[model samples]
Target: MLLLINVLLASWFYTAHGQGKPCDYPVIKHGWLYYSYRGYFPAHVNQQFVYSCDRYFVPPSQRSWDHLTCTAQGWSPEEPCLRQCIFNYLENGHNPHREEKYLQGETVRVRCYEGYSLQNDQNTMTCTESGWSPPPRCTLVKTCSKSEIRIENGFLSESAFTYPLNKQTEYKCKPGYVTADGKTSGLITCLQDGWSAQPVCIKSCDRPVFEKARVKSDDTWFRLNDRLDYECLDGYETREGRTTDSIVCGQDGWSNKAACYERECSIPQMDTYLNAYPRKDTFKVGDVLKFSCSQGRIMVGADSVQCYHFGWSPKLPTCKVGKVKACAPPPQLLNGKGKEIHKEEYAHNEVVEYVCNPRFLMKGSHKIQCVDGRWTALPVCIEEERTCGNIPDLDHGDIKPSVPPYHHGDSVEFSCREAFTMIGPRFITCISGEWTQPPQCIATDELKKCKGSTLFPPVGKPAHMIEYDHNTNKSYRCRGKSEHKHSICINGEWDPKVDCKEEAQIQTCPPPPQIPNAQDMTTTVKYQDGGKNINSM
Candidate 1:
């Protein structure tokens, strides 16, 4: 009975093993499979096995070891582990063979995009344990070389032998030469093809010699298109019938001839009762002429006149009737008494004297004389009276001629002490028994308000306001700009830090057409292709 029971169990085990299909062994490259301790041959359904990668290699999950399951079809993970060197994406480069994972020690040819180059002119990348060796990066390529440059009468200021694209260098010309823009020194930039500008020096012009003219310049050298102004000397004029003219310097020489000629004056028109000697249609400069009155008339002005560059000098004399009578008694002097006042009738050229009363000042000459049939102008005396008391004292200031009581019509000047500002008029006068308003000497520190003025550009029009207090704000729009600018008053000043500038006009463009694989275009777009780089002027 025991032998029969053992046979039946063996049959049952064989039948169950035959019914279920088993999975083939997994052959993973660069990896090893770990078997269970039970040593089951031919993996069965629902069976799980552990696999590990070689040194520097990992599974798809980036782990050293991972489990694989056996399903009814086959092993869940067909390939367990692989070499883990991933492909390095180059920012400005292209790879011929792109893959998700690159095997260790594998190399691929690469090239940089336009206007870029790899360091050391290398063109290959190798996969290594750490990653891609010699990291795939491209730098901007240099386009200009110093050896190919040739400057005539000029030299570069920098010491560099090679320059990258868009690099700038300063150049200076010789003493007697200048750049195209009339400057002795200029800048040049390295561009895609070559240098931005030619380093050639142009000839400069020297100061010109003038005849009968003069200029007020100390400089001996001038650049092309430079203008020089000159004024003709006395009694000289230019061909343009003017005294002043300008000459421009050209590439070869000065534009116009700078010279002046002697001047001539036309003859004078004489009065009906006068005769002029040596009369002519025109007179040369510095010529003189003599005049005489008619036989029965006496001269009333100068008898001679001289011709000048502009016209004649010392007007011609005039003829007048002669007097043949005696003079009357001397006229009375106001606020004074006359001396030597003798007879009622006196001969021509007789003199009389006058004196003023006490506390009265004398005006005009103290003596008068008889001329022709009339007496000369009489002297007058003005009362010297003090109307204002002692000048009012001032704080931080003093008045000149402090001695007072001040007389009527007298004035005093006021000056502030050092570091102080004076407000209102600087002078005060005594008028009609009263003094004018006096100015105040306010300290500079106390003047914290800004006087309203149009000196600042932020103030659009001339301001008539008295003053602006501290911390006041003002707003105005600049010319051609819609946005308003602001200014503030600080410590007695309207400080508009920014200057009013004309608004820059931006060119508008139509919307760009839709691109197949690009983002929407806004104001600008950065696009690159395999072509030469260009620069804007």
Candidate 2:
């Protein structure tokens, strides 16, 4: 029983030891973890246990652990102790093995040095159970140094300059010269040594010239900057100044000279109608004279003639015959006013008659006889008298009697007062103490009113068709449309609206008959009483 107990205790101790937890490995700065394990363990253990140094154990198969029985009993055969121990270790930070040191297979990064860019990969190898792969390398950056410096006016040679480090040069222009643009003091910049390029200089012109001409000297011949004197020619005059004159050749042209000669007039002439007769005396070349015509006859040519240098004058005048007889062509008769027994030639005791146009009255004798080759006295015709007794009251206008009694052959005019028109003649003749046609008083208001068929005829529109009130001088548009109805009525005669349709269908009526040629006539035909009696064969 004692031996069995002891064996049991030993087995238990082995099992417990095999079940021991993995030991934690300390991670060195810039380091990694690595691991290893056994291939087999005791059969009673079935499987080998495995663990990472920093984390918990993984499955045995993953860690290279397996199941295998111990060959000799009593004490387990230490066949390399069934499983070897595993751990982590530190390495050169740049070594590839350092990647395995990390249990999580984490990565580690490297960077370039200051003032340098990375030429290789930006990041180094990652960290694993082994250690960091390899640290990245850093390189040095390139730089330029200062060269030469240059300068230019109103311009720059190159945009920028490179220098070794810190250095400069002073800028300038030559003596007696100035900069065209930019700073006169010059410019400066830092180069390793001095400036890059150089500066330049420029030049300018001189003052202007003055000149003048003398009266004796030809102005066209004078040169620039020349001084001269002046004098007038014979018979010519100069303004004030002896040497007071001066001129210059300006942007415009030459200047300065003397005034030239001018002629004046002496004795002049008197203007008249007859041929000009100049005074018979010695006179200067430009002198002028004039003349006139004698009485009884009028001058036929230019009213006044003048004397010229060549001879007598520009024009000649002559008298023309004057009229002798007092009477001229026989005067036109007024009303029944004047008569001439005969025209051009008149004989004694020839009788003549004077008659006025219809409606006018004669105020003197209607007949005159010639005496001593001339008609007797002239006669006059006047307006005839119109008596209101015979006058009719027209609808559109009115007439009032004159204050003075009308004479036998006198007449008076009638008219519409306002807003009215006289439909008939305003004047009426007096016949046996009564008016031939009476003057009428009428209304203007009713004249504008129309009350007929609204349909206008296929003829031209009417000028007027108004009804007139005789009592009030009022007029209104007229009523009804008739073929004979006048569009307007004036002087008691109707002016009817004309139908244009007839005009469209017909050519104008043939012109009035012309006298038949005697050669063409067979016999004469007499036309009378609207019928013709044919006498021709």
Each prediction's whole-model lDDT (CA)? 0.70, 0.38
lDDT of 1: 0.70
Q: lDDT (0-100) at residue 177 of candidate 1?
A: 85
The C-alpha stretches of model 1 lying farther than 4 A from their native spots are 1-143, 204-242, 250-297, 300-309, 318-537
Per-residue lDDT of candidate 1, residues 218-318 (tens digit): 77778778899999998899987899999988867788888998888786777788888787877877776767778787654445666777667545556
Candidate 2 lDDT over 1-537, as tens digits, reads: 765565556557666787432222222222122332211222233222322322232222334332222232311212211112222322222324433332324454444443333343244445343433443334444423224333333233344444322334344543323343422335444432343334443221112232232245434333333445443332223344232344443323334443423222233343243444465554433344444556655543333322222323223435555632222334568654344435564343345666775556554334444433345444455555543344455555655666545445456677777876554567875654665665554455444333223223323444355332232221223334333423443333323432323325332211111223311111111122343211111
Q: Estimate each model's TM-score.
A: 0.30, 0.18
- Measured by lDDT, the strongest candidate is 1
Q: Relative to the unseen true structure, what is the C-alpha lDDT of residue 427 in candidate 2, on a scale of 0 to 100? A: 82
Backbone collision count in every prediction? 0, 61
